[model samples]
Target chain A: MDTNTLTGLKSAFQVAPSDELAKVICFALIESGEESEIALYLQQAQKTLDESESLKLAEALYQAELHETARNVLSEELLSHKILVAKCLNESGEPEQARKLYCSAIEADSSLESHALNRTFNVEVKVAQINNDDKPKLKVVEKMDLASVTDMVRYRQDTSDFSDVVGLEHIKKQISKKIIMPFQRPSLFQKFKKKVGGGVILYGPPGCGKTLLARATAGECKASFFNIEISDVLDMYIGESEQKLHTIFEKARSSTPCVLFFDEIEALAGKREHSRNSSSANVVSQFLTELDGFSQNNEGVLVLASTNVPWAVDAAFLRPGRFDRMFFVPPPDKVARKAILEHHIKGRPAESNIDFSSIASKATGYSGADLYNLVEMAADEAIDESIEAGNEVVISNQHFKNAIKEARSTTTEWLTTARNYARYANEGGRYDEVLSFLKKHGK
Target chain B: MQEHKYTMASECFHRGQIDRAIDLLRELLAEEPNSADCHGLLAGCLLEKKRLYAAEYELAIALNLEPQNALFYVLQARINLLRNKTKSALESCDEALQLEPEYLDAHLLKSDVYLVFNKYDEAKACIDIAANLQPGSVTVAHYYGEYFFAKGDIKTAEKYAVDSLSIDPQDEAANILMGKIKLRQGNLKEAEYHATFVIIQNPDSNSALRLFCDIKMRRNIILGGWWRFNAWMASLSNVQSSVVLISGYLVFMLAAQIFEDFEYLTVSSLISFAWIGLVIYSWVGIPMYYKRLRKELERFSFNPEF
Candidate 1:
């Protein structure tokens, strides 16, 4: 079209001034490189056109070789517009900027990957599907069966031994003589007509290594360790708890030399006289039956239970042939505390000059867990110091002192309650050990 | 090496084979000679056998072996109670409590002594504290019932007894207390029912048998005659009998005053002599009843029913 004809047609359309005609005039102005006229026409057309119509107009303007105007009109309002603007830029010889826009568009919306790449390629083929393994490959992962993993974890043998425990020499010795010895010398126990398998109740304050001690006992016996959580045995459905308990015991019996450990046994074996309902009473009776093993053999199944409150346990459970052997696990003594403190700080970053004895002495009635917490608090203090100094700072004696001030012993309340029982309620002198402990402490 | 014998002893004890347990515990002790648990257990056997002196010796050795043992202290308390050394028994219970404050058996034993001493307030405090500590404890509930019964709070005592029975229907102490409460309430049939139930469970329960006998004597008294005397005799505890004797002496003194006014010296003198004789009989008989009850309790392996 001649410049004279374009000017004639634009004047004719300006007189009519219809939206479609104005759009036509705008396209013509764009084709003829009439930048000022195209801007004026487009500004008027934008008010009338919707978003999609405006996009189409921008595309037409790009096809008419108005790259800058098309990019300005696109304004990233639509994904397709973005692809079009990138294409216009690439065609107009600004490939770097075009590639960046394409990459960004795909990044913003992952579903646009193939479409963005295809628009860049100007073809139907997806770049990702191309056999270009040389570029990169996603890391491959193998799926695992959860049931098998659980079985592996549940049936695994614990290799812990009494040596692994920090202290409690007397308790360890008693457990070995009563429990491990029978396992090692079955014939000796058998000749005495003693049932190889029997139950023992371990009572103490919380976090005092009761569970850890049980594992060590199992390790000492070289038995398969089956830790039965009270939650696992207690079911919401009636008779289910008994069934679960029965299954656990049967499993232990079948897996000869299995150490069936029930932590927090008081919940499972609370006094029948204290039971509020027949369901709990039934559970107790079921437990008693399992312990008796009237028809079944429990020759190598060692049932060990631990509780923080032995006084809550049923009296019948303490009778002969049941949980006859009872041991009261107390807070670690000074030597044990020292050992525990050392264990907590072994791999941690601490100063060589830090006095463990000072910390141990400060933690008079601390449990093993309490010691671990103290070390953690000290390490945290060191971290704050390190951050303030803008450099690495080792845990210092000062940090430990700070931790000591912050972390009080968790065993005090337990001991206070224990003293009451030990002092007034020690039926049959069953709490002699507790008495001896109180005496030693000058309590 | 003698572990098997020890096992045999424990098995016998659990099976209520007291004689067998005694023999095996003896044999095991002879072989090992240093087992504190064996000694303590042997003392328990002797305690059940009613051999108070032998039990005391065995318990002493056990305590010597494990001096700080709270259980041994409780056993020694029981032994003292059997010997009628109320003071010594209370001291032993205190020592046990000193060793283990929350020992339920020790608390129960202390409560029993308080009941026997007629220290109703002390008994109530001990059992109430135990009850508060372990609300659902059958032993504590039973002791609280006994405390109420001793205080003559029959209604509350019956409630506690029923509460205890609700927890453990076959509990011997609860049933015996129930029988006592029923007898006090004049529910003779209910009293007989509970007594019979307790006897079925533990025929040697002295409290139960006494309540049964008294109930029977009362029923016979309805027809009058010799049954009146026996019923009257059964009606009073040691403390009640002492009070009766004192009142009888005062009444006789008034009668003497009336007789002296009329110049009846011989009748006044006779009344004075009878009153003195009655006082002496009461002084002897009251202790004998307690002695017989304690001896009967010692004969059984179970906890002694108050």
Candidate 2:
């Protein structure tokens, strides 16, 4: 593993050499820290590796901790190389390709039956288990029927609670008391004629965990979760979109003790005045009608909608009885940022000395997703070294500092857009939370 | 006897055929619902599909079926990791290690969780245990490269990554690591070459794709917008666009100055306005042109040859 021996091995490998000799020479060059030369030699060696030899070579390199080289050595159409490449792909966050390679692997070898290798499939399998079906059976809706409301709503059992969420203590407490408490103390609320169902809108910068909070709220209340996709409700045909919205509301009512979450709610309920067409206007009207729930009891249904552009939503949706409780999900505070960093770093190997608090303090404008990406960037840096050394390298504080320099907070764009609404269009002091957040951040 | 069916199910799972895999697994489960392996496989598949609640249910069943299994705990830890429950993930990994002291995967995962907490000592301890358990494991070697890369030792990281590639040249993580190391070393061409090669091999390698894009942007800035645009337009054998644009702007400026010299203030102002309009149009139109090109590229229909 010394320099002289490594140089000799490199020379030996350069001459007419056997595969065994080449492997030893390559490994020695790697151990001796001649990376550039080794990479060049390996690239040259790849041309000589046949389909089967390539698989063996890939497997050997994989064992030696050279993941990228393992992936590169494979021929695209070769089935045997797919499994080797797929494993490498999964480790690299290219799960989509990893999945395909795994499938190819299975076709080539009936022995490698472990599904644990592919993360994407595992997610789907979990989905299948949740729905209690072998396949994701889309509910068959009889076209425009009064009794087929449940068909439009997909119910999921969520286990997320306040513990699962990072930071946002104030928002969590507020939501718990106003929304979750009603479900928790239903009989007491009923005695006061206070129905549990009403709408609340969570507006904030994107990637700040609005959807996460909504699910946690439902989980805390132990309510059935129904996530309404806007596309699913918005039909191109006339009256269909409205009918879908109506049906969704009706389904939420029937599936009482339900948290009906409308993600990106602005899309479904944008301002009617700004609409260039009548259909969107009608859809908004239908949404309002459903929120009113004139003929039905919405007692246990909690309508939770989230939007980054709260100012764009129709004014009616913000009125006293509908979406009345507006909570702004701001970017993570210092404590939240530290917690967010911890949350993202979960199960990733890093040096023990990384100062999370320092990173958190420095990352002022970063959202939850921003912090996650920061950790990922740092992890990538460590992974590269780990592969080279043939040993696990630690993610250091310096890696994080470097990553921070490269990573830009996406919140700047959201804040710029929100400032316009808060300053020029603060009708009835609706954007006070946004204005406060902007001020607090020294914007 | 059931290995073939399991393989088929795995194949289905790998092919992005989640529903098909689920169906096959369900059938296998029906035949032997009590089999811990079946439950574990089903749970794994569910986890891949992001059915956390269901995956948890299946995991619980699998764990109940085999209370002593360390793999179950590892899978549970993985699920917890996805859920962002770092403490629980670590605890699960710990439990897995306690059950089977030599469980390298569990150790690796535990190290990862510790790293997330910035408990680097604990993370390294786990990695050390894993290395001892399986000295030549690709997973271990990859983690070694990752650790060094994270520590900002690009030279050492490249060494480890190259070592890994020597073993398996097709290793995606190693390639990405090398691409990153190349970038850090200011070898933009090398980085681009690695990323471009990876993208060709696996279009779904988003990291490689991103790296490739990053290289392009960096190169573009150095190349300058005018030159980059010219280079792109050169495909159409058209240098006329740039020539005309530059000539038109110069002519407008000359005309505005001439009008000012003649004391035709209104005409000069009018000419200035027209000049401004043309500048504005180019500003808007250039971005639109790039956007269209990007959209076409995203379709994966654009040839690399172009």
Candidate 3:
């Protein structure tokens, strides 16, 4: 069979193309090592081969490290074949083509979306690496145009109220008295010349339910919620970020009884002196103007913001009528920790009497998200046990015991830094709440 | 436009906003992939973040794009030093010096590599050249302080540290050196003040944190003695520590043999037992010290003035 001429083998395969004969012809062609003849054979046989024969031949060729030949044999019309061809192209150092094929395959098949998206990202990285390796080439440089920024300001009509939140009872009460009460009774407040809408800043360690509390505040007040993403307002171009900020403020003002929530507000309102970019200072100024400028009417447009680093925010934003009410959302207490753990473990496969209270007591200093992760870690143990036992294994006290040993509170580091700020940098009693919280926690 | 972005990225890098610098460089590189300065600055930012391999890759591309750039070679030397390839790092520094013989950073980095290898004379030579090149350089003053401190000249080290701090009171490296100098001089309060100042500015500074640990250990006698002993052991390089241990063992063996020759069997056996105990403590002391240090750090309360 190895001694057979390439022309005879090609004719034999063409006369009656079977998987075995196609494999033999591919092997003979590859063994012959005639570059032009092999290229001619592949080009002529690409359209003639059926799907199954092409797939088998391509698989064999791919295993032999003939990537281009395998890619040439596979058809793009079929989704499965396109994926195989994409793999071939990626292996053959044609990542851009492979990315395009994967993208098209994702559009044609929803089930392959995640896998195709991941492959596309990997190939895109490869393309970037290749481009980085190339020598300097003179090309027309295009300026970054910010003519149309993507509006990622998510508007919510109905959201979960404070009832759905896990902990921070004092924060809820403060928000209710200072923020929710105004929206609930605007007419009564109007008689006393008290504005119904003002700014409130929720600041705390991350994963302590600041963003959730902001959402719940809007829900409790029965107002429209505009969850303003940082990307929605931040533009690389100078003045564009300020413009976007104004547009977002206008949109919120037009919708009365609306909660404009900015998560990670420090990114947008950091101290101007700390920022090297002048545009960042301009953005902060724009934010302050939107909050309480003479031309701006923020009546019925409540501004709620949350930041993990409250000390980084500009002092100007903390004045009266602009983020006037600052709430410190500390990590959950003992009782709140138990409730959070129970909430996370509610629908999971778990034993009824798992001694969550005991676990919660052990999980001191855990934030709400930390407790959720603890439950997840416990579930992972249960899953491993189930896989080993070849049956269902409900999460038990033993799993929680194992997880608690491995889990460390991420709040400790944040609190350690906050302690310094609270103790030393507590000018005007801005971090007075943090100081009290630290003392209460025996820091 | 690319130049503007590169300048912005460089400013971010100098401001210690490493992640933001990396992001801006990535965006700029996407538009201007061939910009070697962008790649070199990105590598420096990645080196600050301790992404060694990625830094090396970016630096390699940068050097490939502009083979004659001395700054990229210095960055490559930094990545090599981080990876513990001291010889490769020296070669990179030399390559940079070959391109630009008067490069101050190259001289300073070569000094750093020599200091790592305990080649004090070579380090001092590099520092002297750097000082001559730029007399007002805070970095040169800091390196001089480091060299004198390594040579155990506490008075000279303190003088250089004060000089560096006078040049720039806010310089982190100078302050760290001053803190160490004060620590060695038994001025715990002054040492702690320097450490805390740096910490308040940048909480993630490991050197400042380590200096704080030393000051706190000194203030507390029980943990302080053990912490000091462990810190002494830690200051020795792996080879140096091993040599010390082996020398101690050999001395003990010689003493035991001399005692055995005099028929002092109990004393010789007692000496052997003491040596074993010392070995055991050396093996187990570091982890225990670190555990205690962590607990102490957790319970750290601020001084009223601080």
Candidate 4:
């Protein structure tokens, strides 16, 4: 029948032969709000589909919201329905159960060739992304992969550009002798040269030059570097963290003679028991496991982590040989401060009143970050008032004084805690003067 | 009903679950003792199982049951050969040749047995005949490759080995023979990979085991200290591996007491042993290698050309 007959039949109880019959009935039921009648018709259609093994009828019934009937009708002897069930479960947030059904479906029919199964399992997706020898291992997804290792190792080996990281010459030389030289020239200290070292974590307040020192060490070392960010280090799954951890180590192994850098590293390296989120704890477990692999199943690989909150980090990370060395990238001293100030002002115009020697001495309690803030504040103040006369402002003592008055150091609480951690970390005050100054005014 | 072959020897020869199949056939053979196929298969199974005495009587019965069949004489030749009765084996081989000149398996077996008896001319002739009959057969090509390889015709040997592998990738002999060719050519990485592939595909392969172990030993010697550590890590997988490695160490230490090459040899032995353990531990986990071997075996049975 055409549209006219179908329209005419709509007012009475009539059946017609046409491709639009199901569509007409569906629209009528929806328009009349006769849900109960619609449901009955769907159930009957589903039964017929089941009896006849017709996918068309089941699909139509499913569209009609007779889900219960539709589910039964499409439940057997077809891979299409199996895939549909998996889709429904996945959409409903039952992926684990869906994975179970998907695996069973694959097993039930050996010929079930599926790419979705590969994605759901995460096996093939990782394999395709693998950049290793022929068989690119999935282990790079682990917490200790080659990307992070290369970042850390290459960074550790770099001293060319940071050869003049400005002020920490003695400290830089010390790191070079202790860490950099040892890695670069393994035969120099043959007896002490480590194989697949435990690791090291840098702990200090923000801008105390902790990151700079870490980078300086990386730059000086003769290895590849891998800088792993927190976002890339974690995942939103129960076992994904463990898998990622495994992948990380595998990746690291691929690019050996390298370092794995975890900057602001405590994100996943936090104390497991204290980890508030289960996902965070899982990631921590993966990290620790990867660390263990570093020494046991690993060699020539170094794990370098830097953290501001050293106290919040996992206790396991600090045990002997693991982070065997924790250095404090202390805030610059008067001499160091003068050097840093001079380095910043080298190319700038300075007058007779701009006494860096006095400025360095007076800025006794300021950290490196505080000094930068002071500089910025003073520059703005000088420009704001002095340049109103339409002349280029020159930095002077008055500007420094006014800026010092305006800039407040925000590292008090942090300095106090960091000092305590240093005492606990090295106890002997290897950084005695820095610790003493920090303790005097810290929280 | 399919019987599974699983005896240590049978399984090693790729007769998967064929022992159970043999046992089932044995019972069926007892029930229908005169059945031609049953008698023939029982004799073949018995010969494969290395029950030489029983195989002798069984083949005799099969021959009596069907004198005209050439396959029966081939079975008799193989069994006689396994028993070291070279003259009888040669006679059976001759009888088989008379019945069917195109029987490559018989000709191939005769060449191998003749080679064992130091009948080089006869062996070469037989091998050449088998190769001409089935140019695509890896087994025949392998024998020809072996002859040329022994005669120092490295070019001819290499070509034949390549030909054998092209026909059958999972042939342990072909893979191992090519591995040696690559080893002598100083292609250590390629050689090691090929040898390692052989061992991984067939861990219990007695023939390929020495070559595989040799390649691993060579790696440690050439690759240096870090590699020895890597091989050690690989070997720490399980008990069997631990025993072999530890024993290899003890053996190396003993050799060290007597040999000037002790230091290097001992380290090599330790690494090789470690390699075994590593191979054992990692064998199952080294996905695709053995699975591909299994697929290859499946392909052999699945003869799409037929």
Best candidate (score: TM-score)? 3
What digit string (tens of lDDT, one per residue) describes model 1 on residues A283-382? 8989999988897888898888999988888877888888888898888877888899888889888888888887787788888999999999999999
Question: Listing every candidate in turn, what is its Cα RMSD in Å to the true structure after a full C-alpha superposition?
Answer: 29.5, 35.2, 18.8, 30.6
- List model 2 lDDT by residue over B15-69, tens digit each: 6577788888899988878888878878888887667879999999999999899
DockQ of each model vs. true complex: 0.01, 0.01, 0.07, 0.00
Worst 10 residues of 1 chain B by lDDT: B297-306
Between candidates 2 and 4, the one scoring higher on TM-score is 2
Interface RMSDs of the predictions, in order, are: 17.4, 23.8, 9.7, 36.6
Candidate closest to the true structure, highest lDDT: 3
True-contact fraction in model 1 equals: 0.00
lDDT of 2 at A349: 79
Q: lDDT tens string, model 4, A296-366?
A: 46566677788877666777777666666666555566677777776666665556568888877777656
Model 1 vs. true fold: TM: 0.42
Q: How displaced is residue B15 in candidate 4, in Å?
A: 70
- Candidate with top DockQ is 3
Q: Scoring only the second chain, what is candidate 3's TM-score?
A: 0.71
> A157-241, model 2: which lDDT tens digit per residue?
9458989898888889899888888899999998998879799999998999999998899899999999888887988777789
In candidate 2, how many Å is residue A233 off?
1.0
